[model samples]
Target: MSDSEPRMIEILRILSQQEKPIGSKLIADELNEKGFNLGERAVRYHMQILDEKGYTERKGYSGRVITELGRDKLEKGLIYDQVDFIYSKFEEMIYLTDFNYITQRGNVVVNTSTIYNEESINILKSIIESGLSVSPYVNINEDKSKGKIEVTTLCGTTIDGILLNEGIPAQPQYGGLLRIEDYKPIRFEELISYKKTSLTPLDAFSSPNRTSVMDVVTSGDGLIPANFRLIPGIGREKTIEIIKKLDKIGIGGIIAISDEGKDILGITVPKGMVGISIVGGITPFRAIQEQGQEIDIKIAEEIRDFNTLSPITSTIKYGLKPVEHTPQPKISFLLSKSWNLIQQVNFDIEKRKGDIISNVSYLKKEDLDKTLGIMEETYNSNPKYINPYYKIVNHPSDDNMVGIATICSLSIDGLLINNGIMSNPKYGGLLELTEPPLFIELISYNGSTVDPHKIFIAKNMTSISGNFGPNKILASFKEIPYIAREYAVDLLDTLDKIGFSIYKIGKPREVTYNAKAENYNFGVVAGSGLNSIAAVRERGVDIHVKAIEQLMPFENMDRL
Candidate 1:
């Protein structure tokens, strides 16, 4: 039968389904309901043609009914649709079962490049529908001249397990799907440059290679942290899954993902919320690593579970091990500058202070000595606070010095002196509760009024349990005063005449990130590395630096 005969056969099927003879109008209505959309006049014309062709016969006063010939034609049409569907399914099966290149023993060689285009994505969808785990990245060389795709599985046996289950004749050889080919190696620096130019937030976030060390220290042994919901995962679907889980638990907080998929830092749970931090960044991990600090097994475990809520209780249950932390050279310089600025500014302000914060008792030599002594004891005891990873130096000479120095600088600059930790003895009493006086508190105090902004303290500060003064607001590490990029640069410049570049600051510029699938094509431009970029922009410095800033504070902020 001709291709057009199939349309006529569809009409015959409608006639046979009816209990009695059907008119052309009724036949047309049925065809419309079935998506044929033929007009009654046209159906009537077709019925005459069917009669002449001997597939249909006219009944007494009734329009037409399917004869034996028509019934045969209708059956054939149904089989045709079924065969067409089976053909597509077979195509998918062939793609999944057969490999373009296989190992010597016929082990499947899965080319990651096969999954990037439209045709390949359809095959990938079929594979996923069979409940296979798919990784977001394929390690292919950046150079397009060599047509090779790198295959990476979450773990070994992922491919073999799937292939064996499908009864395919394939065996796992090496960890990767492909054997070594004549491919050019892409250097780390080149990759970074390529990513800087091309990678988007979504691409970076969804990339299988994107690995983040989540710090649950922010949220410990509590309900799922609110911040966890805000960070985006590999793609929209995965991100939606995270949002659904967080919403199911019934907590709300901001979680912004970075363009590079590196940093997911923000306040997840609000202040006073007793939840672990699901929001995290790897900057600190990288920072410490850059300084030759190896990630302890415990730290690595924490990183693995950071995105999920499983190990949160354990995080709170056990105290962290003491890891030696020395800031990077530039960071060290900034820390020294932060300390010197405080001392220099404080000395200059102490001499010309006519009238300062009302009822505020500035640190006397004895008080400074007493504060430093307390800090030294705390630092020696708690290694967590001893080597400030990303914040101010906790050394005896630098403890409480950055705050004091910032206050002095601001005071000398003629900014209004606010109620800082050093400005009031009660604040000192409040800070004294924390094991290490590594904490900084900044309260707003203009001539006759107090600023409505709550006093800023770290989320983990021991002083928050009704011990600190009333109206104290505990904030996350990112909310620290000097952690702001502009403020940090100012602080850095104040202490050291020689300037340093801030790598982790600024928003991510334009870039491309793609993840394509059937009925799905995600391309992020301005959206690339948003979470990572945001982490840098929002959190200011890197993790170690921000970690230090968490216990750090601002002085004379109103003046500055």
Candidate 2:
């Protein structure tokens, strides 16, 4: 046989016989026992080869860890010359969202702004020095009472979220109590708290170090709330196995690797339906450690299985995407926005008989093979449905990415599949929702006989949930009421001429909203839904929106 047996296979066979991956010197001594006369160089060569093949994936540049293939080959005396092994690559770091880079390392700081001062900078430095991770952030909001927070980023800074590199309770949600928003040049005051991890890739060859607080926290039952799926051991195949289990369960996933006796091929997983989660925040966060950075990977207490429904439930929260949301007759400012998002069913088809759907016909693997065999006859035989999503890029000038429009798609069950945005770690699944072009209706109310000279004006557009009251509909233009109304009418006419179709007639819905000229403004509203018209339940998000606007000339809006 060609001495081409995989270096990993040979190393593993040696370890299986000897029970571990050993140093080159020891491996040489052992090979001598087998009458192989393999010198130190030979052993080193094998190690190098194994590492290159990723059978022994390395971390922090030099520390190598064995993979699933290595473990299997070790146990089975995998033939070096011809045996084939499967290889897997770790997911990108941005996708590693389940845990962040914080722990009991006291220096952890969560904030709405940037880190400032010597002490704060020290914490950030410690994070990098700790070797595993250190963090500085912008726009991270937290509300401890209800367990919710919104994280935001202004400059598109990509940093890992809170990490618990130690003992953790099962399925913890770390974000409920804290929220982060993103903005420019962070000021330390906005910083909230963050969970700090103990391990750093810096100076790994040196003796492992620990922080005083980190020791206690990692060793104690410190709360680290993040929803995660755990696999018991390390290896490429086993790593994939656990992920497959989670996939079958239906919830979207992110992955984290637990270091064990052998491997380095750790993968990262982020929260939500896809890896592309992004937030444009108004605040940033602060760092935790001041100095002497060290990663604390101490396991806390053992977690007990609390929720028995792990097997019964398949998703994070039981939410489903509708193939289409019924359109409400858009009359108010808020309703109009929702109407714009509402898509109508255009494909005409009758329900297929359950008889055909039920088919009850058995399909053998052979049948599939035959069907595919026929398609295989063509040059491009593979069905197009299985094709992966192609990513799209855009110019940096887009605001909230509103400058351009992207195609959004969805699965039959309503989960977002893809749309116009690039489907990377931060933009996955979100493809289903798009902010359609802003459309407005202007009615020139030249004061009726019963009422004063009240001119029905328009302006200040916002999200679909914004309202129809004065504050939201652009009252500033009242001084230029004619200009505003004409502008709106012109825009509508332009849209109509450009081929936009109205699915429903208009109606006037009296919406109570704050007003400038008067304490309140009541107005008529008209809008359309996706395929038809429908209404959404009114909530706080409504008044806030109708009350303000952005992008075009409008008022700044938020809930009162």
Candidate 3:
């Protein structure tokens, strides 16, 4: 590939991300941000070449847009020159990992795989329990529309990252098929050097027909994906210490570490270096694939906060339970229900003299016992969900009824309004569990009739139980004037002390965790008041939720 071709490919990539045509100057600026030194003139020259090659088309003063042909070329072209791509990418990810074994609070690399059926989840659980993967912790995401579940596991490359942080340099040598006997790694049957291929070697070799990971699980003899790495002999003891520390924290994948100039699983180590053999993180997905489950796998994709991951055993114990399918309500019925809700809310607002209302939701008298148990279980499983300032209260109207009051997220808007700061509710979204969590799915307030958080809960799209940090939860995004920065910060601190979950507050005119603010405005992400209720729903309890139902005095609520 020519130097110009790479630049042209990048230009096409930039154009692909835009909905409208972008001029050469903007493209040049973006390229510079990506560490490319291309100027506007050079970008214009590349655009001209791209136009000649039918890859891009000029859009009348708006600049150039990538054509269908360009997208196809970008997807299919320039493979031969990428032989060292995987090696470089692996190295980059290793260096990016900043997970500290002590605090367990930094980022670690992860591999994501998708399975279409619920039965496949059991296979994954078994693999995690059997210690065939990198770590006991995993992240799960559910897509009800597509009928698929995405599972994220710690990548073996994270070992390199941990070692790198400890002042040790580790080199990835090969990804291969390791033979296992009596559940012990014995040898590498086949190897693909990182320097020899553009594709990830483990990904290349993860075929249902080639690996019998499930058989190994049941019979203790089969071939599974593994990798080889090398580190200086001097760091061997330190590496062992790190491994033990990781084990204490429920993370492991290093199968064996060899001494100086020693061979591991028949792979010879270089002089002054020691060999390390690690089980592939994708082994569980490989097992699923061997069981005739269709899966899409991406190897060592990106770094995620270690705190966001939870022990796989926790998932097996509290993971999503299969629920019986119920017939969908007719559109007319839904519309009628929505209309009734709107009228009820209006009536309640009038009674409260336009004050923001906090909804009081009720649990069925019969379900009170089971539902409360689920809530307690959730709080025990992850202490982050514990809110000592909040608790269930007796129903106002009926002696036998039970009620729970959740502060409306809209109350934040009201608070800002009282302070002379205008606030606009923007979206209700599912925020991904990351260090600085971002919204993975969103429903705009302007486009929806029902509360988006309610919709997400009803659709069973939340995974709050498996891992507290990495699971998606209901959150709302609101925009406030940038000038209210100091005031808003003070208000948020007050809200926190009063028990509101404030996710983040953004800088002026910038996107906050994937939610964009309007000009001269900034964004704020607050936890949906219904998160605890959602947790109950996740545990298979059916509860009726009335959002922003009625206003109640804060002093009237009880503490848990």
In lDDT terms, which candidate is top?
A: 3
User: What is the alpha-carbon lDDT for the whole of candidate 2?
Assistant: 0.23
Candidate 3 lDDT by residue in tens digits, 386-502: 332334667777776787777667766766666666777776777766655656556555433356676677656677766543277778888888888898888777766655667
Q: Model 1 lDDT vs. the true structure?
A: 0.27
Candidate no. 3 TM-score: 0.52
TM-score of structure candidate 2: 0.19
Tens digit of lDDT per residue, candidate 1, span 1-560? Answer: 24445467678877876778889888888878656878988888788889998899999787788899877655433332322323232223333332211221222212222112233333322222221222221222233454322222121112322233334322211010101011211101100100111111111122122221122223211111111221122233443343344333321121222332332121122222211112112222221222333221111010011111111111111112221122212112122223333333222222332321111112334344443343334324432212111112333453433222211112212111122212110011011222212112221111101111111111122221122221212211111122233443343333222111111112122111111111111111110001111122222221211111111232322210
- What local distance difference test score does each model get? 0.27, 0.23, 0.72
TM-score of each: 0.18, 0.19, 0.52
Q: Whose TM-score is greatest here?
A: 3
Q: Arrange candidates, best TM-score first.
A: 3, 2, 1
Better of 1 and 2 by lDDT: 1
Output the worst ten-in-a-row residue range by lDDT, candidate 2: 423-432
